[model samples]
Target: MKNLFFLGEIMSDISVEELAVILEEDDKWLTENYNKLIQQYPGQMVAINDGKVVAVGREVRDYCAARQKAGLVGPLLINVPHPDDLEPFLI
Candidate 1:
């Protein structure tokens, strides 16, 4: 098995496909909870790991440091814009 670095985390003995699956799952989790999350963390950046909220703040840099300090690997980072600040978009 070889060591792989993903999102600043070293994943040992894991395949690329496995990593993809993990990321997909993360996306699904986020989508499912997006509405509730928007209300909870409006205008803030959120870090999620293992389907749970971990570190949160206004700056991505700060969240990165926080993730590193907490020894988190491949946590998903998302910025939740406040509803009032959202602009209409049409396609």
Candidate 2:
């Protein structure tokens, strides 16, 4: 709570343990309040890359895939526009 702040659009950085504690207390509350908190803080990036565990490349992909398999709504990826599609993207 002390070191929490917003960095940019749809991003946040907070202590993982603090988040875990909040999640444990009331997952529903966390879900419901997520947007409000982000709005107040604005541009922020949450870092989940601390501690003993580390995920990279395939591992990250696999983790996301597993979540999707479990029926979780994962993050969306914007497709890179090729040279041919640049006009459309710009427009």
lDDT of 2 by residue, 13-58 (tens): 5465855553454434434555453443233332122221111123
lDDT of 2 at 61: 49
The TM-score that candidate 2 achieves is: 0.22
| TM-score of every candidate | 0.77, 0.22
Worst 10 residues of 2 by lDDT: 47-56
**What is the Å distance of residue 51 in model 2 from its true position?**
24
How many backbone collisions does model 2 have?
10
For TM-score, the strongest prediction is: 1
Write down the lDDT that model 2 would get: 0.34
Worst 10 residues of 1 by lDDT: 1-10
The most accurate candidate by lDDT is 1
